[model samples]
Target: MVSIIFVDESFRSGRVCWIKDIVVAVTAENMEAMRSIIQRYRHKRISLAEAGATRHRSIFNGLKALAEDQPDVVIIHDAVRPFVEEDILLRVVTAAKEHGAAGAIRPLVSTVISPSADGCLEHSLDRAKHRASEMPQAFLFDVIYKAYQQCSDYDFEFGTECLQLALKYSHTKAKLVEGPPDLWKVTYKRDLLAARSVIKEKISQEICVVMNTKDEESAGHLLKEVLKKELNCVNVTSTVLDHTGGNVQKFPTDQCYSFICVNVVSSEFQETQKFLSTLEESGLPLLYPVVVVLVHCCDLTLAPLASKMESLMWIRSLAEDMKKRNVLLSGLLLNYSKDEQKLQESFQQGASIIAALVKERSSALAGQLLLA
Candidate 1:
């Protein structure tokens, strides 16, 4: 599939002239994977040299190679504006592919004036006619590469503008897009504060892991403990359909299903026993079939949990909960870890289990899992 090319240029320009570095990074090929990696380490600053490539040549070459072989829609951007939104990228690239040239621009804040001798301004142009060209400039591979292919060192080194290059050589008139306020470049120290604020707002929305907890003798602390190290897992007292909206995106399913429960806590596990009991007593709609994993740790001796109280304390408790006929158990898991990677496996196991159950009982995997 043709994907958007994320272009990031790091240059010590404008007021911050003390730094001496001009880097152009082009991320393409398996765009989603690259993006996921970026989001995973958003706070971390990654350098091209660490990836085994030193210069901007390697970065540009990597992008060019991917472009020639893959032939995908490319969106070139500047690292000065680190707070670029995905919507703007999508809009610009989508238009660029259709029109051959598309670039984002903002209103000129200061008047462009020319100074002759002293520190006095001589001439100034109408700010209305001119606009401050910003990042997130997008163009098709053939259109952009062609411009770079037939260019000089000035165009590659001193000439840092992407949109101007495309227009200067290819005679391609760029579709100047009015960018959002967040598109402002991080030129001065004040711009960095603005960037930080924008980034903070972007991450304010929490990623919630909603699970059902009906344990009577449990305070819902241990489960939260395991998840606290990885994610924000909130255990709902029951399946409350009234709780809607907020980041409530779900997988395709017809029924209302919430919660990931582990029924096979050893007999001594009060949380497991009471949770099953509470689930049986709670009267809720089974909008979607739920995912339940029967888990028991192998490393730690869980024989005390399973055999100390009774041979079938955990199994009978789940069976009793099943009698409620509220929701269906979709999947089963024997063991799991609190590790981040292991958490994904557990989620997948539960998702697959719910997918099968939904398919068997209802519309089947129609809206089972929620998108992050």
Candidate 2:
């Protein structure tokens, strides 16, 4: 919510990279993982602290460790809820500043029941009257810290609610904010699988560019130059692959989030198809959505735009087929102008749209074309 950075702690498999400062609290057994992640981030705002055995104790320990930093507000989040959004975080923080404590809640989906000693249902709770408390809870720094100090050992060992603790010790009534459906925590094995899929979709940021040959005058080469500035150069790579099914040499070894294929003519998509074939055969595991942007460059002053539009229609059909494999296909018609200034402006705009497609990890433009 504030302009800070938060990086994910790599445990078994998942990864997260966000913009916020972070203090990771882990159990003593997970100290090794914490050290490895801290080493990777290497930032002054990022630090580590040991957690206690129980949930409330762990949170208290984390707050105690942060006494020196003296943050204005402290937000407590569970690592399992990977889909916490920026808007929800902002809501909790603002409410906490106004009300001293705040937490997220979702409408209960099922009725809760209590069983008798003989195993028969004794009572049933009205689902409409209850809500499920979710995470990304926030509190005023001083309010929560002092509340923890006043907590009894029994509360520390058995208490599960931070808002209740604040209310009991600091007399602070917590504000409840409704959160989105994606705020569910990963509590089971199947939940982890869902989290993995969500992570793959949102974290696809790396991109690669493919061109037909080594010609500097080619459209792909010129576009790649502009893209390098729009995206991180380390995440963008360029290489040559011939149209006659030749191997694509000199590409990045790591996974690519998107592929930009540049072609001078509208009908020449064989090289792009061959590149896709090679990718399928390489056997490298692709867990994220991969975008394939087809950029067709032609001088619009010399050729009629109507004639070129027909050749690009094939892309729509091809895109529909590629969707089955989780591949998105989009087309960009770079209608170059004879005027140097107009051509330069068009190139800049084209680069921006391509960069947006990659960064947003969006498929809104799939099976569609833009005239740049």
Candidate 3:
């Protein structure tokens, strides 16, 4: 029997700003397929069109419905749990199938305190005895749903936990496992930087730049070739498009995401400024919140960054403009480094700036569809 995974969260449903009402639901025969779906998107020819099994309702009724339609097993997780690795998911599902219930947990990082009668003295629980519950909670579908069905309006209106609900009525004990620190929920502004850092680390080592640069009147083709040799894991592909006027012939539906550039090259700083200034006035492509960047530096000397910040200042300033549009943007100066290895590293790093930016916003939004 296939297991269903429920990744619940309120993401910026249509507009990429306020995350008020949204939930993504999906099901896979096993955990490996669930992970491959994420890794496969590195190429530009993947599809993330899975049908969601169940949808979360506003308030607490969402869980109530999951309990109504009992299945083999239901795994409720947080979409904000981007750091959730596949192995962690495998362990929980397997355990739930065997023991009827399982959940991921971790040691608390903060003290647990409650207020006293008159703001004087309260009690605090020993942190060692308490566990901070993370997500990917799994259970035999029937066992959990029945518990919800038996719940009163009080339970249905205010319940914030699945494990506690299972424990209260089904009398099931959840087998808890430690989770990685990155599994921390993204609830504040600081977390955006942390999320970007994680993506940067992942792209530094393994990346493939497959492109069709046959019709370029410029140096994008040459950049791709040299970039392949410099970065250890970076792969490059540049072939002629078959009557298609695009770098990537197919829209990646699964593993990889795409970031397309729509800017031309110029030498004079004023001309470059004029080119980018038009982006602010033009909203043709700015309709989407994710910002887009146009790189102008194809040839510049790489002298330890500090020696040449003026020529690159245009790119930095442009990145700021793109930020307002919600797209993180930047420019790269393709220049010779005195150290041959260092020059190559510079080129590879430039390519990664674009690749990694694409991966972060390609989350598949699950809706309407139900589980098997």
Q: Candidate 2 on 17-85: residue-level lDDT in tens?
A: 432346666767878877865565443455566767777877776787778767788888876676777
Give the lDDT of residue 315 in candidate 1. 46
The candidate scoring highest on lDDT is 2
Candidates in order have lDDT scores of: 0.48, 0.73, 0.50
Candidate 1: which stretches are off by over 4 Å?
1-59, 206-372
Tens digits of lDDT, candidate 1, 287-366: 22343333332221333433433443444445345535544332233233446565555545444443334324342322
In angstroms, the error of model 1 at 187 is: 3.6
lDDT of 3 by residue, 72-154 (tens): 66666676766766667677778888878888898989988887889864889899999899877778777677676677766
Q: What value does the lDDT take at residue 95 in candidate 2?
A: 96
Kindly report which residue pairs in candidate 2 clash with one another. 4-19, 4-20, 5-19, 5-20, 5-21, 6-20, 206-257
In terms of TM-score, how similar is model 2 to the real structure? 0.57
Model 1: lDDT equals 0.48
Candidate 2: residue 49 Cα off by (Å)? 1.0
